[model samples]
Target: MLVNGFYSVVSWIFLALTVFAGVALVMAAIAREDAYRAASKNTKQFWLIILGVAFAIMLLVPMMFLQIIAVIAAIVFMVDVRPALRQVSGKGGGRRGSSSDGPYGPYNGGR
Candidate 1:
């Protein structure tokens, strides 16, 4: 009974990590290519491949070593790359009094 309970907890943890990795992969894909270059990070294509492989490993293998690598990659992208990309692309960082226009056009501030 105790062993089964422990395995259940472990399984939940693994699932959470896998989901996190998947979210990171999708974010990397949807971000602008030029933003990646402007951020001076790895090319969008390179990160796409890396995150895709990491997500695959999380989904297919679920081995500890591979999962750790995937999680690390996701963390690096989220913590370092995403923020830099956002800054370079003028999306975030809370700049005040900036134009409300988006890259393509202006919205009425969402209504």
Candidate 2:
């Protein structure tokens, strides 16, 4: 019974990680291809293939070690590559304004 309970928890954890990879896959697809080059990151296709495989591993393979490896790939993409892509595309790094910046965006005084 204890083993069954532990197994259920483990299954849910893997499912959540798989979902995370899936979300990362979608986000990677949405990003512009040029952004990857501008950010000096790998091509978008490369990330797509890695993340797609990561998303698939949890579904097609039951090996915990492989799933963990895939999750690491997804994490790298999410934490490192995505931010660089966003910065290159002018969609990240928060507001780009002086100290008078407002919540919405830059708060430029009337010229």
> Ten-residue segment with the worst summed lDDT in candidate 1?
94-103
Instruction: Pick the lDDT winner.
Output: 2
What are the models' TM-scores?
0.82, 0.83
- lDDT tens per residue, model 1, 3-89: 999999999999998899999999999899999988899899999999999999999985799889989999999999999988888
Taken over the whole model, the C-alpha lDDT of each candidate is 0.90, 0.91
- Model 2 worst lDDT window (10 residues): 93-102
Q: Give a tens-digit lDDT track for model 2, residues 1-111.
A: 999999999888978898999999999999999999999888999999999999899779988899899999999999999999888888888546778878876777874
TM-score, structure 2 vs. true:
0.83
Model 1 pairs in collision: none
- The positional error of residue 86 in candidate 1, measured at the CA in angstroms, is 1.0
Displacement of residue 93 (Cα, Å) in model 2 is 2.5
Clashing pairs in 2: none
